[model samples]
Target chain A: MAEKLLEIKGLKTWFKTDDGVVRAVDGVDLHIDRGETLGVVGESGCGKTVTARSVLKLIDMPPGRFEAGEILWKGRDLIPVPAQEMDKIRAREIAIIFQEPMTSLNPVYTVGDQIAEVLRQHDKLSRKQAIAGAVEMLRLVNIPNPGKRVHDYPHQFSGGMRQRVMIAMAMSCKPQLLIADEPTTALDVTIQAQILELMQEMKDKLGMSIMLITHAMGVVAETCQRVVVMYAGKVVEEAPVEALFGNPRHPYTQGLIRSIPRVDRAAAQKERLEAIPGSVPSLLNPPVGCRFAARCKFAMDVCVKAMPPLKEVGPGHRVACVL
Target chain B: MSEPLLSVRNLKKHFAVSGGVFAREVDRVHAVDGVSFDIGKGETLGLVGESGCGKSTTGRCILRLIEPSSGEVWFQGADVTRLGPDAMRALRRDMQIIFQDPYASLNPRLTVGAIVGEALQIHGLAKSRKALEERVLELLETVGLQADHMGRFPHEFSGGQRQRIGIARALAVDPKLVICDEPVSALDVSIQAQVINLLEDLQEKFGLTYLFIAHDLSVVEHISTRIAVMYLGRVVEIAGSRDLYDTPLHPYSEALLSAVPIPDPTVKRKRIMLQGDVPNPIRPPSGCHFHTRCPIAKPDCSQRSPELVEKRPGHWVACHYRG
Candidate 1:
């Protein structure tokens, strides 16, 4: 078995919202082996982003609180680490790529300069060497005419190019783990493919583990080796990509798999998709027992009475359901 | 086909790009350049493209939300482009629009009932206050929302519920046509399916025609009777949904379809990934709009633009190389 690069155990991240405490990450246990790609799939407010943020201690304090969890990075607990130490680990050991590159990238600064700044701050490289390294990073990500485009402002670059620049910057420090939260959601399909391809290439070239956070199951099936299905801030299912798609154990996962409109010739005749009936439960005062019980078709009395713990159903396949 | 419900001819929307201190018009961004299509009565026409590809612009042009630069918008039997404000107001009764972001599209201060009833009141469809309330409640139920939800604000509802409210508002006027601009893109995977299914159910029940504009090919394939692929302000491919996805003729359409990551992990596709970014529409490539990124480009591709020509029965393609 491959060595584990990151292991999250019983993680619980909560936020103090106006209504009450929102259990954004109720209890998520996930692990990523070295050089592996793990996809965390969930809808908006499912707490996938919150879980990713907790890995780096990026969540804002006061409102955001780590209730009970162990974010183990290379066997070291990150939850209790000092802010200064956590800052060092961020971007050096682990880096994140956001959904929107326009807001993420500095509008005033040139893409090259911004990338170089990361290298300079982390590696303590000279200005000239850092700029050279930045250009090289851009080249690595397949940006054309990196030398000239390096001087161009963010506005000059298109959405896809800006995303590429973001990838270059994130990959500049050569982190052991890359956390991409909806990285290609903002880009067009063609550009999204290019970015996904670039990320795949970067992962292979650098031998880094990627925790892909996206709502799109297609993206997960295409990029991820293992898949983690999250709902209402909890891990409902985890399995290898093939197993998850082939035979989804959890009701929520099953609903998601069935809901996506397939482009395959077989699905050409499908008139109506199997859309899940209800919306995701609010984190604030979430329903008792199974978080998905209200919307789940297979909900039993036990499911509504108490939450099911994540239990292995098959080899490397876990599901959180009484059934 | 009984003169098709909506016919757009040479539709173009160009925004002037001004530079220098003088703010003079240096060029124009050809958002929707000479794109033409027809939507038969009670048929769903899916407009798909990457961001900045003018899919949304084309939809907006039909409703005169963003006035087209030059085009003939033939709705029913009248040229909507020439309609005065008062006449256009009357036309709105027969046509409505559903926006992508349900949160932003709705008025935060207004109750759900008011939001849905506003359209009916504006169109003079409701006879009395009680009648308006009853109609609003009926619309709410039609969209899978409860009567209690009518009293709630937008913030009280989830993203999916907000989308339902948007749908209810669109259906309030009993419009013949609804321009749904990326309606489900803003929704989650599970919620997206719900909205898509609701749209389909509503379409069948009311015999409502839809110009569904979205970027996701798979989602577009599910609801659309016909699909139109746009690239940089031009319609590259337009065909029946099944035919277009199964056997895409245009290089752009083929590449775009190939890029859609299928949820099934077992399916491995040979993706014809295009090169580089979508060229700036302000200074678009001289010939074909997609020639800069066309994977199967020839010498002539950069010299002359291709007109949309019917390649097969009910299938139109704009490509020099494609038969």
Candidate 2:
């Protein structure tokens, strides 16, 4: 119904490792609508980051390859796009922010210089105008006394402030889509709240779609309108945020939701959290059929015998598990 | 608290920052300033705060891993801070720690068995090689690792598996009080649950006391019988887990609780977000350290610090207002 901004269909990005092929992003299908926040959630090795990185063509060519599937941006497939063309597409049409703000930023450069560089390259603005625009961007991100703070180096800012500067740089080009990969993972709970709030404000102000890649279920529940649960390089479940949390279809999804201990429930006697048994199967030479079958309590003989296709289970809800 | 198993009084750890040509002490980061608490026998006291709040520092001070600038650490009726080298070494047998990053904490050169058994050898808990091997295998199995994993290196295991190894090593000492410093923070959601359950099981089985330090409120609440909220190296509030969540007496605690991203989307929340990042610890706020960001801060809040007072039965808060 709503206009699609970014659509990833059955995309498989694998890395050629010595141990074997690492099926990082195998058979993943997900999409982001205009002005919507789509949360991609999974554990550390679930390929959520790889999928996000693949969209920007950021992976190393020698070791990584898009073995199968299509990435559609505004009805145009991006897999065939030239390297040089992708450079233009990046930061201008779609920008990204990484988890570690301390490393991603250039410590030597001033905050203003970093932000202005993005504007000058993409917007092609004059040096004076770009510097002025940088201050304005800093103010937009709620950095106090932007005019003075903009001239400060990355080290001058705290972890939370550095993340704000990163956001300002990413939004400088006014990209249609913004991809944040664990942007608040390194931050404290209070600071995380500030950053998440700033992101929502920025998104609403710019009318841009955000692909928030995070492992925190609470973060997804608060910020995302829709969610895609990834497991072992596959989209285990996809649904609206309400549907995903209210009635999780996939066993993996249910396990993840239940894994989070609740404060309200903590009033009662401490109960053992229903933790999912077993670790994620190795991405290298992944198991045949459903990757989650080994850990799934409801897994049947048929589940391990044949790969289950992602099927629509309910209205606007899709699941990869046969059950 | 009936002679708590461990009691800390006026604990303070200040890290000096050097600068200029001669590297003079420019300033000091008041990491843990005047923090006091007691952990009863077999009780879990969850220490919670933001990144710079010094929860980890407090834990380390208790174990003498990081020497405190000033404090009295009384464990098992003896002052740990005043103990001699041999006495402290002996005390270490009752106070073991599990670090946050499992990858860095475990020795890479040592095999799993060697690493877990090292504690046994140091404490002289095992009589012979045969007994040591038997104990190591039992500890490994208790933490849900296979006997075959004993020969493998730290790199051979995943994050979850590595964490289990770290836990096994901690338990090898048979410590009466285990300081878990963000033990589950590095693991995935599902694995985090598994580890939490394991810790609880081990706690009950061995009658172990824990000082759980983490940034996540929900996890702390779920695991802890009592929770202490810290801000700017000071304990702002301490209460029963349910009381702290249900009726936070301090403004900082209220804001901190509200900031936690609730996993249920259906539960609409009103987040009381504080402005600006955590102030520099080297030059923390003069009075109430949180007054700068406190929404209800008064003139007196900036001029004088508020003493933590019991606002309700078993609930302590340090705010000038609220209760």
Which residue pairs in candidate 1 collide?
A: none
Task: Please write out the lDDT profile of model 1 over residues A1-323, one tens digit for every residue.
Answer: 88999999999999998889989999899999999999999988899999999998889998999999898999999988998898788858899999988999888998889999999878979999999999999899998899999999998988888889999999998999999999998888988999999999999999999999999999999999999999999999999999999999998999999888888855555568899987878788988899999998888789888899999999899999988
Whole-structure CA lDDT of model 1: 0.91
Residue lDDT tens for model 2, A8-58: 998999999888899999999999999999999999889999999999989
Residue ranges of candidate 2 with Cα displaced over 4 Å: A266-269
Interface RMSD of 2: 1.2
lDDT of every predicted structure (CA atoms): 0.91, 0.93
Error of 1 at B72 (Å): 1.0
Worst lDDT run of 10 residues, candidate 2 chain A, spans A263-272
Q: TM-score for chain A of every candidate model?
A: 0.98, 0.98
Alpha carbon lDDT of residue A289, candidate 1?
97
DockQ of each: 0.80, 0.80
